[model samples]
Target: MRLILPILFLTILSIKAFSREVASDSLANIARNAMFTDAYIQIEGKLHSKKLKVEVNLGDTPEQTKAGKEYSEKLTGKSHMLLS
Candidate 1:
């Protein structure tokens, strides 16, 4: 019974892990700019906390640059480089 329970639990975990979908190209691109990348974050440890880092070097795209300019001009009244 003990062995059965452990096997069942492992099977469940494996199934859940396998159920996750692979990221699409756009989603993978977005992940490069997500909070999980290139950000210094404080992580809590059992005894102490430390600043953790995840570096993400993003190659800029024209679409992202245009979006940023639009956002800044429309929302913040700031001039930004126009996306060509």
Candidate 2:
């Protein structure tokens, strides 16, 4: 019984560690993709207004300009939901 208890505890610890590693790897992949993804930017509003709305593409396309206006709008909606 004593031996079983220690083995069980170690097994649980190892499982938790493995899960953490997997989670971290996925997070890293997400970060890497975001960093390399092509992006398009738009600037609106007049300089005199002292404010400008800047937008960028967040899609996985190789060229953001080729993604079309609709693509950006779609991606932006998802991002807005996440921000909210």
Q: What does the lDDT come to for candidate 2?
A: 0.59
* Model number with the top lDDT: 2
On residues 41-68, what C-alpha lDDT tens digit does candidate 2 reach at each position? 6655554444445466556555545565
Stretches off by above 4 angstroms in model 2 are: 1-36, 60-84
lDDT of 1 by residue, 4-80 (tens): 99999999999998897766987888877776423222222232223222222222566655555554344332233
**lDDT of each candidate versus the true structure:** 0.48, 0.59
Which regions of candidate 1 are displaced past 4 Å?
Answer: 21-84
| TM-score, structure 2 vs. true | 0.26
Best by TM-score: 2
